[model samples]
Target: MKQIVIIMIIASMLLFTSAAATILPPPDLETQGILLTTDVSALGIFSNNADLSWRHSSEVLDANLNLVDIVWDPETGLPVVDPETGELIEIWELQPEPPLKYDSASFEVQMATVYSEDTSAQYGEIAYSKNSMVDTKALPASMSNVENDRIITYTGLNGNRILSKENLMLSGAGTPGVPSALSTTCAQCIPPGCTCYPAFCSFVDTGSKIDMSIVSATTSGEVRNLNKIGGGDGERWPPIPSVDGPAHMSYSIRVAELSSSQPSVGYVSTYLNLENSEAGAWCVGIPSLMQELSINERKSVDGYVSLFSNLVNYESAICR
Candidate 1:
């Protein structure tokens, strides 16, 4: 009976251990909670936002392809007008559909600071510095302190504890799940000096509840930069869509121009990165568990998510 009782006790202990193993400890929860609180809430906005911008670019390209040389009146040097309508047919009007996105889709990706200056980057020396595009300059005076409009975390009184204002342009900049490993040989690294040019729609979705009725994110806290690299103060694109401070990211998405125009939305279900060889590379997209959402958008590159804009137009609120 004693031996039977001891065996029963051992079996119960084993069961208890297995159950406890499945539980997450508080410290780790606290650590990971920041990511859930912050990036998780905005996943839809990022993925869908990129999808919308992609559609916008496609529309612009279509317009450019169809455009013909304007017949300008030699006397007035102005674009000739329609004789029947008596109104000038603007370049945009000539397009089959109204241009829904910005004209340019180029952005500055700072990875190689030691090399070229233009949007073109040098091999092995990718530009590594980013800048601010959605500072208060993009916000109306009345919207001050409306924290949801941009990505920023406060410290002391107004000091943003996370990334500085200049780094605002780098949302989804680097691969989220890529590990931070260096290459000793050129063959082991990505083809260096790769430049990404992205375009945006005119209407930048502020991601505030007022803009598109988005869920509020905990925009302030420490984010893990597990895969940090690049030049000047080092660049960071973590293993997930996360940052180490509070921020409100603004995105370029086309809203309803007419009843016929549909709202653009995409569900980001996976992350894909191909560096080095297939041994350590990851090129898979993870589907989200949420109810079905349309895959309306992807990045300029096949699965890249960061929207690269060349020009940062404060007036247009275009963050490249």
Candidate 2:
């Protein structure tokens, strides 16, 4: 009787050990987060509010001066009439009298988030940088001739002949030109005898944020057995075990437009799922799991124009 009891005890012990070996625990969870911000400001001419002016030395020319007579179609010196407005078409008008010291100006502001990702790997990598990730574009007012307008000719004080011409008749009298990294090689570098133009856009500012969390588990049936032992009470175990290894979140902001006609604004949001492999566990075989990440971004810019003296002042507000 004693021998039979011993044999039965050993068999029971073997069964219990086998059951424990077959049980697997849950996996681990890891997370990472990121945020970004940016700002931009600029000054430049506003086309809609532009004005024309003429000057000779410090003297302002008279708008009604009979400097010259011009006919758009010389063959038909007869003045043409605008069919839409029924007004005599004036081909050339004298530049603004008193030579407008200043005209229309504008201001703008901008902001954005920026980032990049590599998708070739199973658990892809994410990255961001000032030099590589972010980009900006803006438009500046260029020298333009007044349409259909021309200067004829005038006699100078010494009887020397002076020809009235579009560009030669006037010049931009706003802030002196400043060097630009985009247009020139150096900050102050300018071509000899050439005047620099004031930049339409200036200076970019940036910022960011981050948040993270992590959890871990093992591959073991004992975890499930513990739930059973606790009378099917799921709460007794770490919230459902995860088979995946870890997860990470990344954010990127981009300043898409600094000068486009379209509203200078942009926003983006997305969720990504990734795969990872796990090493074989004593209780459970090797397996693959899915990881997840979330992203959000935004950007915007506003422009304003103001006149001081005879020049236009350009300004902008940016947010990201």
Candidate 3:
């Protein structure tokens, strides 16, 4: 019961994505004294009710958090900045649950969406925000970086549309990561094909984390802090290039706090759904309102994050 209580508290922190659109509340971004980022702020969730919605914050990368390692130009003795694109040659990090293998060309849309290049400033330092991450949302931070020998993957999580205690996959309960609902794939990863299309988004998870220092984007414009994940207890991962040729994208719920047993992470769409519904949340995270409808009128990761930027840039009240 104590553990469950702790998980629920953390859940409420990230309950914002599941917030009902009915009564648009003011920015409840800050909980307790923690100044949360736009991405991880607890917008809304039900009172004492478990969110059955299979959400995932699997793919969005927080610029503040993901500014992993700086890429230096040995010749210039300074950070490398793309002259034309203006993208800084820095290793921006990511936190996909199962760990989306890195790809350069394929992730172009995601790169262009979340990251921008503004070489106007020297050293390519662009202003961005910072956020906090708990390797273990349920247990204390001291428990982080420890060995977690549980279920290795969340490949079969789409069975139940409405989550209950029975179906809950706990850390050491059945899965490798905690916040069991926080799956590896963002959307309906059904079977053999196991495609997470229509809503392809993911973010960072717990356990292996990058340095939380580089919280500023060098290229300028508006570097988005995306790809926040949940279900702590993984390996200690290093900073990977933010724009690797193109890249990979996943989605999950922005865990207000990491937990060992509760469902902390979720779908990027569900994570972005701060405005009541999926489409509305999509509107919050995309680049523009104009939608390039996919198979079932679903939006792309690029579109998803732009709307999110809108929340941060234009609609400050909701996030700030």
Candidate 4:
């Protein structure tokens, strides 16, 4: 009898263990109380009062990606929130993740500094260090008269914390678009004398509820009458559609002077001409960018529940 009991107990334990293992699904967004959807319109707005209940759900299961906190200085570790004013104050820096480097041929990334304007803690200002990453195709298709202008594209904050600003612009000045890793090698990459651009974006506040907007800019500008470029339109350029979704909108920046000849800011006056080809025609601006980066306030899977929990908890403390 005793032997039989022992065997039964062992069997029960084995069953429980097996059940637990099977129940442990893969890392996913749905397990975190979210519905993974590429539809940007479904994500809702970036405002604090915006309602996400309609888009909220607890069903996703496959994890798409993961984000890790880079870490901060002990001095910068402890966060400061003005008790009276209810503001957050701390030092933040941008660092790029692997598969992407500041001087990669694909894209260049650099960290930027963000400073609070007043003690109010409601907003802040940011400025780049003139450093940039120029890729192999350093110059965008729209670039004219400049051969060294490279255009590299990448994701993530690149170690630089996003300041409490309303807008951000990442440019390689005059070079071909290269991979994110080799962005810093070309002679005319950025910083004038340096081979690449330094860090520029940072901050992990997906809670500040800043709003989200994603923009894909190309270098197809009309250089009409001067030399008829062989392309879709004599002056107008062909649109490069985004594969991500309709939520992903693209724009074109012309480095042309208001006039045909003179250049401003060492480059021609830059202009962002937006296209209306997106599925939902979603808008891309500073506020929109914030929302997208915030993971659309969605939850994570059971495996990644801890990460999402930590991020949410962290945001509460950081954005206070």
Q: Which candidate is the best by lDDT?
A: 3
TM-score of 3: 0.17
Q: Per-prediction TM-score, please? A: 0.17, 0.15, 0.17, 0.14
Deviating ranges (above 4 Å) for candidate 4 = 1-104, 108-192, 199-201, 204-320
Q: Local error of candidate 4 at 233, Å? A: 15
Q: Which regions in candidate 3 have their CA more than 4 angstroms from the true location?
A: 1-190, 197-233, 236-320
Clash statistics: count for each candidate: 31, 35, 72, 83
The alpha-carbon RMSD values of the candidates against the true structure, listed in the order shown, are: 25.2, 39.2, 23.9, 31.9
Model 3 global lDDT (CA atoms, 0 to 1)? 0.21
Model 4: lowest-lDDT 10 consecutive positions = 5-14
* Residue-level lDDT tens digits of model 4 in 1-320: 11110000000001111000000001111222222111111122111111121111011112111222333447868556766855454343344333232122222211111111100111222211111211211122233211111121111132221211111111111111221111222233223332222221222212111110111111211110011111112221111111110011111222212222221111011112111110111112211222111122322121101011111111000000
**lDDT scores of the candidates, listed in order:** 0.18, 0.18, 0.21, 0.17
Candidate with more favorable, higher TM-score: 2 or 3: 3
Candidate 3 residue lDDT tens string, 180-216: 1222232322222222111123221211111111111
Which residue runs does candidate 1 get wrong by more than 4 Å?
Answer: 1-71, 74-90, 94-136, 139-145, 148-192, 198-320
